[model samples]
Target chain A: MRLRFRPVDTSFYDLFTESAGHLVRGVALLAEMLSDTADHDNVAARMREAEHAADETTHSIVKKVNSTFVTPFDREDIYALGSGLDDIMDSMDEVVDQILVYEVKVLPPELSEQVDVLQRCAELTAAAMPKLQSMKELEEYWIEINRLENQGDKNHRRILAKLFSGEFKAMEVLKLKDIVESLEDAIDGFEKVANIVEQLAVKES
Target chain B: MRLRFRPVDTSFYDLFTESAGHLVRGVALLAEMLSDTADHDNVAARMREAEHAADETTHSIVKKVNSTFVTPFDREDIYALGSGLDDIMDSMDEVVDQILVYEVKVLPPELSEQVDVLQRCAELTAAAMPKLQSMKELEEYWIEINRLENQGDKNHRRILAKLFSGEFKAMEVLKLKDIVESLEDAIDGFEKVANIVEQLAVKES
Candidate 1:
């Protein structure tokens, strides 16, 4: 029996960038949902719909990974990138799920701030994705991504510290805590993506 | 101007694996600290020590990455793996730090159980690291790792459901929730390591 090797394809990169775009869209939907003064059920439904879209995008990437022989980058890198992107979506979905499940009616000011930062992080991540395929362009975006990630981290620490202060009611604190942590996790996911792109640039150079 | 390429050395792989070993040890230390009925300050110190060790390990890997011309795995994979392993350790440290900061006295039953699971997951991750260097051996351990990960997921879901059942005191519920989520995140980190190992095996085959 003879073994065959397939030529590497760049399709995985395309699919991955597409998935990142979906994540950005999902986060955008979530931002809108959070901003609206809608019923909990309606907000929950919209959040679920956004999550479903992210899941579909994730499935597409997974299928591409399983079928592709040659990937533009390392197969593991592709998987990491895919999983990192999915994690951002998952973090957003988890926050919405918590809000609905806990029957949380009010969003804290701190949580709103975290969500605002998260939306910015998602936007930056989506913008950076297209530039990943071009190493020259990566340098331009990579520094910005890192700066945004650091900003997210600072926001996370600020919110977390405020969460522990004896100001808010117990339930309010609990709700805001979860939201802050989820937002931080989502930003961390974006940072992971940026890290991968930066490493790719290093490898290509 | 002439460009120079240095020959790839085994040092990068050596440093990465060594860093992985350090991470596994850090997690073990965290688990031990969690299970101990030690003073709060003592536990916090111990956790901090583990974090510092893991940070030192990360520094070593990063230094090697900066200087190395070639790596055994994708440079991004190397970075991802290193960062992921460090993340698991950091999450473990964070859990312990929270316990101390929050002045938590008794361990939640669910969180204690998850710590045991995390220990097992870390051990599996450590065992898988050497096999990653030899891709042919990865498949043998892949199933076991996945099985363990599934078990961790089951535990996560079970505990989370219990959390929502209103069985514990409100403050207890809040603290335990954070600890449980962190433990589950650590397990997910281990599962990520397994996933990457499986990908490496497939690519090698």
Candidate 2:
């Protein structure tokens, strides 16, 4: 083990935790958007607000990193992790927006399954943010997130195969495909954040 | 400008140039894939080879970064640039593979236009890699890439609108959309590389 001066800044953790909190809300909105009775316009409007709020959290992380004399981890790692979280929100928001603008009347049930994966990833990620301070017991967080991402990947291919299975109209397939991909992108974004956290743990350890 | 001890390791630049060189070939293969009389299998096979070769170059850059004590630029930036180039190849390869797998026939002419933008971006990137050492007159390279990216985006939206225009069959639309998005992704990959180069120059200056 290497000994170094560790200056503790609790706000970074607090801000990251706050950031993850927004994702929790964001995922809920995403789940709501997938509901059959979803008010597409209302859900999408709220999603936009949630995404903007997530962006603010990201910007706060950046500002804190710039102003603070010492960061909890590396400056670059902080930026990567912060932006990684923000990217997830952007993807989720894209899904909602696609559902709205494309006027996709019926979303496949499998999409909800993918959102379920995102919800789990979000919960895991939210639970893991504060754990950044200890850098202990972090491995399981990334490992589980990776597992969920793999499941999401499987779900994605299954969805695509179905989309091409001659069930839905080509036009509907076109619109739904965008939503599906955005869902996949959001899941991938979570995996990226996990990777960043994992890397941070490795560097810290 | 800040004066810092700059150690020149020509290999990193060479490897980057070599990586960008693969993109040039990759884009050419992409163009060939779009031809009316082109052998889709052969073009796809060649693209796979090009992608594999690009992967080797990326690995070489990583290995060199790990072994070399003094790099030309930041190690992260080097990794980012090398992988950025590699990602473009991956997206191109994906486009080719999708065409082959989906058996998409009669591709839209708009796709060829997008590939034209990619070819231009690849050529400019290949031209710009050597300029990393001087970091001079490189602004035009990124500016051109950004301009081409905007052009590609416009082409992408036009292609999407056309795909959704009720002309092609839904199944065909599904197939072509994958190829179209992959092409757009490749162009976006180029823009990302340019952005990385721009940031590198800013850091160096």
Candidate 3:
């Protein structure tokens, strides 16, 4: 008879929760960046730091998964969750980078709607990560994210229509459109994260 | 002990191959749409058909994965590969639709370089899908794709430089930049697919 002895590690759940916490901070900075009276230098710097912190957490998760033969969940699920979380941060960081690089002035009021959706998603995701081990109470997290994504989509279409309605100059329209699409991508990225979490819960349950 | 007998379904490889075939046709139509003498309606119709076909194959893969207890590889990997392939096609289709809708008269010469990259990636990806069943001889496919993506990145930077170099009108830069970025996205997506395939191979080997 062969005996197996492997201690299940619960640290991954803690790491995932920590990573999601960075998302909360990242999105808050994103909202600050979108503010009209913002200091762009400080906002960009803070977002950059948040993104780096998120990256480190992702790297830690990947390393732990690679070293441990018996994981808390499937290997690919861990990878997918880590990558999904990292991608959302990347999208948020890109929005801030573009705003700075393009020297975008005259911020759109419509962008606030997308930021609002993002903040809600961050909160939901941060809340959901801690419950991953229990595999309970995650249904609402994903459902709310889906609803929020739909809201972001509607906001995106409205913003695009306004951009093409000739209210702004052609140059401003171009600059604003990139920022708008980045926000949309960030929102969609959050939905991807939520979908992965839902799948993980189903598999674990 | 319980006895288990489940047949391995190989139809997934065929469906994936079929989906990659659509990518080949999709990118080719995208190239045709960029041509100065393109028959826009016919090309759009064909691209739409290609996108629909790809979507159907993706749905089939997901359905099969859901119903079967044993998949050929990780379920998440299958999902990621399917969604990745579909995303590349979607980005290609968006490029065509934007070009047509924007109704820009002049197509930048740099765009042809991007189209060339897309066509090559489509070819490599289609050729690699059949090998998924064995996961043999895949190293070259991903290496070539990574190189091509780097090439695409360079082309993207040059195109952006040209657009903002005061050589183009504000409206023209806006219209063309969107199209260029979509091409870059398609190229990046191919790399993503290749990366997923590499990971799957590593796990399954």
Candidate 4:
């Protein structure tokens, strides 16, 4: 029987999985924030909590990487992945915050489609985090993310065009544009995390 | 006498300097684009050429990093700094393009102040690139950038407030906000480059 001597710190995988878990929760809050009946203050407060939780996960990952002598992957890659996930959360939180602070009462219906894209991305990212151990099946994760990002881009343009299509009042357009861009940034953040995972996997392989 | 054997490739310095030089020219074009009597088409054409030139410099730096082994600093830092500089040019280009494509007339005068900030950052960056070799006097470069970024942030808020102040028509506010945000992004990009330089300096020291 062959024995593995330098056992990779498997906790890193768990931490990453935990990090993605925060994103899943954060995205759910984002979706809730879009509803017409939603309480803006209540949702924003919960989102702040979710964001803080995501930050805790990120800091845990960073602290672990700094203290551990032998990490599962390159320290930089670990840091990038950790913070990349955090950035997505930040973007999501920003979307919710904008919706609240901007006092934007009427959101375009098209924004719901963007939120759907983000939900799918969060789920896919959560699924992919655990598989970092085997470095197996991450290709599809990134490929799908790239695909979703393209979809998000199309949605983004459509949303922008709609905003500029003389549909909404100018003040509303100004407020919603910031929110829409934040949603796009969140999706792009997912793709960035997937790319980091792809790079790490390639180097490991 | 002990002889130094592992000579660092110094061309990276020149390439970075060349990259910053492109930014100086790009910002000049951006300033010209703001002139009311200026021909948008002519200025946009020149800006495109300048952007392409910046891309070439970025590619050269990436190619050189890939081909040459003995880099002066970490390869990743080189990549970050190179792309960081490239990103600023992109933001500047986007501002000019938005002005042209949106056919935006009567740019807010506050925008010129933002451009002044960018011009200073470009010059500071151009001055700081060569100093990477000795890792000396770069603190002021980044410190000034942070200060400038704060100034830019203040300007951004003021601009947004003015846009929402009911002074301009809704359509005009929509168009001008995009341009204003792009200008703010360019300034932020400069700060990002400075941060990379600061990190590289710390690591090398």
Candidate 5:
């Protein structure tokens, strides 16, 4: 069997970068909602809007994948990137939903810090995605993404430790713990995106 | 450039099947432990042993992946399978750890049922793995695995709804909620293994 070689189109790369940017924007919106002192319904509505936008962006990428015969990266890589990005939005949406439904009034300082780390991690992930189209120029960004992920992990540990300290009331503890876990999950999704980008860098190199 | 086609050894498939079998056994042990009225420490110790065994099995698979020149599936597929199987053990271990550390005395009825479902999911997943080595022989089992996953998902939703019904005390509710979520997570891991097996079936077909 003869292997047909064709350079992957630049547009697919652009779509992927766009998707990553949307994910970053979604995380930023989530952070803003978390930090907000407004009514619960208002914050939840904003987070839901962010999730809807991320969903639309993911749909766009999927449509491109369905129509294109060739992709800039492996088909599985593209799917993973799309799914991983969407997971970040889903995680945020879940946290927001829980907060609103439970009417959780107080936010733990530790959980607040985790959300901040998650926002920064998403930003780094978004920054790294564009560089993937030109792997040679983006090698340093991959390293930076890894560093940000490590920082997120550290924050996760700190938050978990505080949750187990028996300081907060049981209900407060449960609410804060779930929020922290979801934030960590969002960061994990970002880390997966970075891992895929690093794999792309290796393949390109 | 000529693409080199290296034949995959059957032994790796065998190893994965064996590792999956170990995971099923672990889930079974967990279900039994959760149902038992025995000493909490003993139950936790048993769960820890199963997790350690699964970890060792995962390490073996990783070693095989690193040293083997040819693989039966894509490298990413192998990694996904390895990690997916390991996640089951990790999730179960975490649940048991939480139960023990939190001094949780009473288990929720619905959560126990989910544990049963998780055990069955793991068993079906293990059953499906050996079939991937020769996909034609076990197509029916692969379908069954998917059906079982869907069933597990339904059970998860039902249990989660029951958990938040405002029946239990605040601390009790929190503990039950965490356990239910953890069990669902374990089932999700099992479903992921089934998914990978289904993917392999597709490739083989």
Candidate 6:
């Protein structure tokens, strides 16, 4: 019997999962931030913690890529995936930070719809990260994320219409619009992460 | 006398310059788009062309990196520079598209201030691309971009203050704020490109 070996860096997958885990934590905090009883300051603090964790994971991936002679996937793809995940976290953090900095006490009820889209995207992304090892069973992840992103766009348009319908005060409309746009950016960031993963899978397979 | 043999690929530098050139065109269209006498439709159409050209140059740089045995800079640096330049173009295009899609006439006069920052950043970026081969004389480029970005931040806050100051109607405030944020994003995108260049220069030096 002969034993064959290849230089496999499984740590990349582990760090990816770690990065996705941070997204889950961040989105959960986002949901809390949107809730009626939510404490904005506390939620923002928790979000900062999650964002810092995500950044650490991203740095870890970059360092690994820098030092590893053989990466699990293409080096560029690894870097993109790390950066994509970090972008998602950063955008989500911005949503929380804005909610606090803007001192927006009353969030539009429609904001929940956007937050729901973010939660679903995070859940799907968390589920998809592990399967990156084989690049199998991942098509549905990005497809669902895309569909959710479109749904988010619709929510955004409808919310903007309601905002401009003269119901919201001028200042409230400005605050609400800022929050809504950040939510849209978070959804878009998730789609970008999924797209990168899909591309990586195709390249690896 | 003996000539040293080295694997030098200058096409990457050429592609970077070409990408920066597209940015020059994009910002010019953006400036035109903001003018009171501007034809938004025509300016947007022209912007789409410039954005497409920038994407092609980015792809060319990526292909060159993948195929070449030795890149002029670190592989990661090449990818970062290509991506950073592309991001600036994308953000600029988004600004133009937002104006067209939102039918936002009557841009705040303060927007020109932001546009000036972008124009300076574009010039600095275009100037810096040709010097990537040596990574010399690049400090002032990023420093100047950083200064402009700070100036942009100040302009952004002033514009937001005016937007929320009850001067504009509710809907106008929302629309104007969206446009302002995109302009800021473009400025931030330029700073990001400059930051990447600074890192690349540090690495090569």
Please compute DockQ, using alpha carbons, for every candidate against the native two-chain complex: 0.18, 0.19, 0.14, 0.17, 0.12, 0.15
Off by over 4 Å in 2: A1-11, A14-69, A73-80, A86-90, A93-161, A191-205, B1-10, B37-49, B59-68, B136-178, B198-205
How many Å off is the CA of A89 in candidate 1? Answer: 11
A41: Cα error in model 4, Å: 13
* TM-score per model over all chains: 0.63, 0.68, 0.67, 0.68, 0.65, 0.66
Please write out the lDDT profile of model 3 over residues B1-205, one tens digit for every residue.
9665887555888888988999999988988898899987788788878888888888788777777777788777788898899899888987876766666668988899999998999999999999988889999999999999999999999989999999987767777777898888899999999999999988977
- Across residues A52-165, which tens digit of lDDT does each residue of candidate 4 receive? 999999999999999999888989899999999999999999999998888888888899999999999999999999999999988899989988987897687667767776
- lDDT, candidate 6, B52-137, per-residue tens: 89988987886776677766777667776787888888788878877776677688888899998899989889999898877788
Error of 4 at B136 (Å): 5.3
* Candidate 2 per-residue C-alpha lDDT over B49-75 given as tens digits, one digit per residue, 9 for 90 to 100: 998899889888877876677778876
**Which pairs clash in model 4?**
none
B1-205 per-residue lDDT for model 1 (tens digits):
9675887554655655675676667666666656746666876787778677777777677657766776677665677677778888777776776676655667756666777777677666667676666565666566876787788888888987887798776666676677777777887877787777677666667
Best model number under lDDT: 4
Order candidates by DockQ, high to low: 2, 1, 4, 6, 3, 5
lDDT of each: 0.71, 0.87, 0.87, 0.90, 0.73, 0.85
lDDT of 3 at B187: 93
Error of model 5, residue A32, in angstroms: 6.2
Report how far off residue B95 is in candidate 4 (Å). Answer: 1.4
* Model 3 bad stretches (over 4 Å): A1-105, A119-131, A134-178, A202-205, B1-10, B37-53, B100-103, B136-166, B198-205
- Candidate 3, DockQ score (0 to 1): 0.14
The local distance difference test score of model 2 is 0.87
A1-205, model 2: which lDDT tens digit per residue?
9776898655988988989999999999989988999899998999899889989889989999999997778898999999988999899889988888888888878888998999999999999998988888988999899789878976876787678778888678878888888999999999889868865654454
Off by over 4 Å in 5: A1-70, A79-83, A86-105, A116-120, A123-182, A198-205, B1-10, B28-70, B74-80, B109-117, B120-128, B143-167
- lDDT tens string, model 1, A6-115? 87554665666777777777676667656647566786787788777777877877787788776677767777788888888888888777777877776766666667
True contacts kept of each: 0.22, 0.28, 0.11, 0.22, 0.11, 0.28
